[model samples]
Target: MEKPKEKPIIELKNVLKKYDDKTVLQNVNLVINKGEFVTLLGPSGSGKTTILRLIGGFEWTTRGEILFNGLDIKDLSPHMRDVSTIFQDYALFPHLSVENNIKYGLRLKRINLPRESIKPSIYKKQKNLQKKWAKEAKDAMKKLDKIQAEYEKELTKKKLPKNKLVKIQQWLDDSDFKYASWEVWPSLMNEKFEKKYLTRKITNDEMDKIVKDVIKLVNLEGHEKKSIDQLSGGQKQRVALARSIVIEPSLLLLDEPLSALDAKIREQMQQFLSDIQKKLGITFIFVTHDREEALRLSDKIAIMRDGVIEQYGTPKEIYDYPVNKWIANFIGDSNIFEGKIIDNDEEIISILDQKIKYWSKYKFGQNEVVDVLIRPEDIEIKKSKGLIKGIVETIVYQGSYYMIEVKHKQYKILVESASEFEIGQKVYLDWTITSMHLMTQEKEKNKNKDTVSLNLKLNKEEISNE
Candidate 1:
């Protein structure tokens, strides 16, 4: 027999949501497939949350249809939609115990039946159910451990040639695992080590264990049972995630979930979220105002402005080939210059600046105003080795990277470098023509329009060697 075909869990068709006299969402169309995790990312007032609210049935769309599994759900109440939403703040009931708070959704279903007619307290049933799931999780963890050991043994079994072993040892050394000096690897190791170590640390029947296990896919283990008041901002956010995933919803919606966390925690959460999404294969829609987070977490991202999708594609496409200027700047730091395009060759472009020419894949007509976007990381920073020389204005350390701001010819541009360059020191900025992102010259003319593209003009062929 042929397998049954799966349908999209949520489909938004030409959705337009507007407040009186203001349109928050415009012709919004999206399809969320079953088990797919998608994120909606944009700045404040960009209508990220509006989409979430519409999906959740908290608000009605001015125009369009919302379908769930081929059935129109536009008029369904929030509770009728099988989807679940996780807010940044833990919206647990203060009067209820942790376990009860979690089962509130299930309890709400029971309210219609005679309260006394129910066979068992929801807590009692939930406890038993939790115990059953706990046992299953424990067994799964053990299986994971066995698999890991088998792999490790296989790695050790290869009585490799002396040189091969030496090479492997060098590789481990370079990875710093050899120097880690821990009895067991960090919880971040494969599922096997995690199961073996964490299982030993907590009871299988522990509610905390269930929460921890859900977050384990996100690389967060331990620290369960800690009150929300005692946790760090990031930890609290992860706790919220743990709580949400513990129930395993088929559709998960995250709206700027990590916005309040510190930078360190945010980075950790980013990786964790990616790992969890892959492991669960559940449909996840994340809404965020952070471009970097969107780029990092999304398989395909849609850039939204004023409730409309400006552009949508893979991160590389959005970053390397933005259709307009606002999108280019929104995705990453860019240096933009405006000048008329005087030459067009499929692989090269000439700007009217006379001093600057670029090599790119996109072509524009002569006299066409064009925009150029060059990422800070793409520009070469060095002493006495660039097309333009400028005095260092500022240097900021960003953990693994350094950002240097340089002023040249009254124009200040930021450049990223691994090695630190001193303030007041003269530095040259050199960028290859291939690094340029070219856009249509009509940006300025369309500037007054919502979502206008900016024009960037490049000057100088190459930095001279001193």
Candidate 2:
């Protein structure tokens, strides 16, 4: 049975962006499925950030549509759209404590309190319960506020342990106070509180619950009272993440959030972010120039170049079967061979005047020039009994393996091996025919050009004749 298609949470259709006659993005089309970690990957000037900003409503598209949850949201403002963004710099308020910083968005958020009709007797019972506990609840709140302020002051001097903070949070959890605030206690104790209460903003209790939950989610429990300046780069990033997620946005946009960190910290944060996204199950659209980073974190990657998406696919598909030479080279190291099909039946090909037999799923026309790519790791180095022989030009040690560059008559091949080889040594290179991947050339102005798909169809007919 076929699996059901996942719903698309965001879509960009023929999206174009320009700046004063300079086109930044051109005819971009993309679909991000719900809860998928999608990355927009490219070097600078590829307009990766422009696509992010357009979807975020920071910049309007020149021509096309942006959809969220199947509805067009091209004109919605950043705050109006149910989206949150974590910028490259951790945008936290230095003056505010970590907990306050996380609560910043929650404080500004407005939510309509739900109203429900109830029996008069039940309503009176609820009101009586509120009146009985009102004074004790107010006292509990005052004491909680005092303790929190004192904790913040203590954090400035020295960092406290997680157990100490947990004790304070435990007190709140154990209390019987369920009302939002003491100031609104009387309003909540009235009849309207049970029937048609219309408070439109998040109450203190709601804000505290949300902030606490997000802080715990990001593992920032003990550091919640520390000011922004007191934290490390990774901690600051976590604070920014907690702040954005506290409001529970439908989607999260991360714009190179880890670029500024040190190598070790960046790697650790990559795993941290991946774990967090999976835990929350939120659709994350991350942007980065690092190919390895994109490959590691993204469920789907869109590789952009010169204001257009050159290719978009899973990391394995893009790495193993790149659509063109540029993408193959940009993605990873590969040895490219430019050759022509010299014979059709025997699958003989000519590369640099040397005839070799190749195997491919798609058939090649006679004398047709094509590009073949073989990854460096796919080629094996042998002392004898191989398809081609070469002289080792350079050998570099890469901790776990050695990268050996070999020079043939007119081609330079790279081979990664566990065994070290000396320079100037003769080496035989061999690989299975199935390891070779044929690349499709970019289309030209001719509308009737034959592509790989057409060649595959023609090949199927020839096989039927046998």
Candidate 3:
């Protein structure tokens, strides 16, 4: 058996950042592996920048240690660390040429090595390596073609027809005979693929390969000659990313890098950022206040409020399993009920007024008061055949979805669906027991957690009763 790998390139241990009376980050812990793109997602004022600053040495941590290559970097200054930060403003010197701007960080360090001295060697080596890989990939493709043609002929000529075997062979060929993968595949099958898989170590060449690929991946392929002002906001952002990644920092910190671009540009940039992260295998800690952006781009998301991280997990986890009522409503649209846990049966739970039954591996005692959260998308709205009935308070026609509000007894349940409904019309609202999400916590009366629904009907009568 092969041995396990070493620790990550950068690790933040019990990190905390404070400003005057307020604490920005509270015992933050994260590990950024070599060539791993891990995005840090949260809203504004969530200390997302503070974590970046701590890693970049722009700000000092009040408590924890920042480690680089498994050594303490708490005392290292920004220049000392190999990390380079790309700020939202581009922060490029207007007077300097594009070439000079790229080399600015190196210049500030005042390394004994001259630009002329290193440029030829570095670029020559990179060009030669690219040529070598291009030839190898070309050769591999030729070999694969010959092998595949031979197999295809053999398969066609065989008297014993193998339907299952044919399909399996097709699968192997489709997979490039394990030569390349959708991402990465088994090490044993491809020697070139496994060349970088050393135990407890990550090669600098591996980092360089990703860095070079990201430059192309982000579509900044020919902008090496363009000046800062000459490029548009989207182009500038891509260059900023190229600058940040050239050194192959263990942690890549992005602070709302796409906010300045137009909607179309933003979408395009988002795809580039997402794709580059995957291809480079870099840990990206992306900070954004946009809910849609966070939902679309993040692998794991941390929804934050004020200076606190309200919830943290994979995008699906946070969207599905919110810790509390605030979090449930924050990340997405949720229909919440401020009620008590009445029955608390072995598997199911009953909320006040609404008896919702769900299978739970977790056990709770009877008579436990809790808040029940149901996502707007989870609740189904039909014109007929629903248990809880109400008059449609409102009907909103969104391009792709519908918002529905149904008044039931004392509460108004909001439902989101692809179906359309009319306002002031009567409708029925119901949900499967499994659709109910319960939160065993106290509720805040004034805070209305129900987001917009497709069709809804509510007025004085519904408000007075509650």
lDDT of 3 by residue, 266-362 (tens): 9998888888777766767777777778888987676666555667677787777777887887778788887555566544455436565665445
TM-score of each: 0.65, 0.75, 0.67
Ranking of models by TM-score: 2, 3, 1
lDDT of 1 by residue, 1-466 (tens): 9845656899999998889978889899988778665777677888988888888777878888777666566534344466777786656454544333443443322113344654465546555655665565566656655755554564686576777667655554443222221212221232232233222332335544454455564444554344455556776666566566665667778878888888887898888878877787767888888888888888777788878887877788898888888888888888776656655543334432335667666556766767877789998999877778889999999999889899887677889999988999988888887787787643333325443322111112222322
lDDT of 3: 0.67
Q: By lDDT, who's the top model here?
A: 2
Task: Give the Cα lDDT of each candidate.
Answer: 0.68, 0.83, 0.67
| Ten-residue stretch with the least lDDT total in model 3 | 182-191
- Residues 322-369, model 2: lDDT tens digits: 888888998998888888889968998887467988887778788888
Using lDDT as the yardstick, the better of models 1 and 2 is 2
How much is 273 displaced in model 3, in angstroms?
Answer: 0.5
Clashing pairs in 2: none
